[model samples]
Target: MRCPYCGSLDTQVKDSRPTEDSSAIRRRRVCPDCGGRFTTFERVQLRELTVVKRSGRRTPFDRDKLARSIEVALRKRPVEPERVERLINGVVRQLESQGEGEITSEEIGSLVMEALKALDDVAYVRFASVYRNFTEAREFSALLDEISGDGREAAVDEAGGERD
Candidate 1:
């Protein structure tokens, strides 16, 4: 690796370790000529994936774009950065595991909905409002009812008793 301090081509790795999240490898390097030290991180790029939009347009799958949307939904919530990273990783893994060159936007939205649901009910509702394109109060009420388990309780009451 080139030395950042002097732009020298003679740099040696002094130490290497995996980052806390295990998403990348951190390397400590030294420039022999200038005796300068610096750090660098390396991460693996598995493969390129494409997102097929609802309007039949295709674009490269962007992790940052996905993370930004989740962050917007999670704004002001008491969620940790680590948890958010894990959530994003989970969604990426799910998409990668599909092994398809292109995936539908609906599928991606469903994955995000599941992730947000497990993370926070409020965030889930927030994301669902935009993702599902809610226009009326009834739609929002239905989502709240579903998340609050009211729908399930009502179904059980209508059935006359709890399951044996």
Candidate 2:
């Protein structure tokens, strides 16, 4: 690596360690010419994925855009930041695992909906409303009904018996 301070080509790695999250490697380097030291981080980049819009336009997949959408839906919710990070990472992993060079916008929206649904019902509904383009009150009510029904079934299953 080139030395940042002295603009020299000779630099030696003094130390290397994994970052706190273990998602990247941090390297401490020193320039032999100027005796200057600096740090650099290295991260693995998966293959670039393309996003195919509804209008048939293809664009490079943007992780920040995906995270912003999820954050907007999760705003004011009781969820933790770590959970949000994990959700984003999970979605990205799932997309990458598909091994497709391109994925439709609809597919991404569906994945977000599924992740939000498991994270928070209110957030899920919020995202679904925008994602599904819900215009009628009945659409929301129907979704809420479905969510409530699922909750009831889960409760019943956990209780190990039907309601008396």
Candidate 3:
């Protein structure tokens, strides 16, 4: 490693430790030439997932993009950042498990909407409004109806399968 202070190429790792969450390594390095010490962090990088749009255009999957959309949806809401991270992680895991090189943008949006639905209703509605392109009240109403219908179906199924 090169020293940032003196730009020396001769450097040795003095100490190494895991970061708070253990997601990365914090390494203390010393430059032998200038005797300058610095800290560096090492993290694992995952392969990019490709997203195929409805227009047949393919783009790389971006976690930041997903997070930004979530932020917009959960604006002025009670959702936590950790919850959003977990939701995004779950979607990424599901996509990776599929072992497919590319996934549709619609599929990705659906995954986010499903996760948001469980986290916050207002957030879910906001996300669905933008994702589903709600240009009219009817469009938003339709989405509400669909969600309500699904909930009613689930309740009925659970009631029928109840024990005792």
Question: Model 1: runs farther than 4 Å from truth?
Answer: 1-17, 26-41, 152-164
Top candidate on lDDT is: 1
Clashing pairs in 1: none
TM-score per prediction, in order, is 0.73, 0.70, 0.65
Order the candidate numbers by TM-score, best to worst. Answer: 1, 2, 3
Overall lDDT per candidate, in order of appearance = 0.84, 0.83, 0.76
Off by over 4 Å in 2: 1-21, 24-43, 150-164
Tens-place lDDT digits, model 3, residues 89-134: 6777777667787899988888888988999988998988777766
Measured with C-alpha atoms, the lDDT of residue 14 in candidate 3 is 91
The residue-by-residue lDDT of candidate 1 on 37-101, one tens digit each, is: 99997866567889999889999998889999999999999999989988988899889888887
lDDT of 1 at 31: 95
On a 0 to 100 scale, what is the lDDT of residue 138 in model 3? 55
Candidate 3 weakest ten by summed lDDT = 155-164
Span of ten consecutive residues with least summed lDDT in model 1: 155-164
Q: Report the C-alpha lDDT of model 2 over 115-153, residue by residue, as the tens digit.
A: 999999999989988887776676676677678885533
Backbone clashes under 3 angstroms, per model:
0, 0, 0
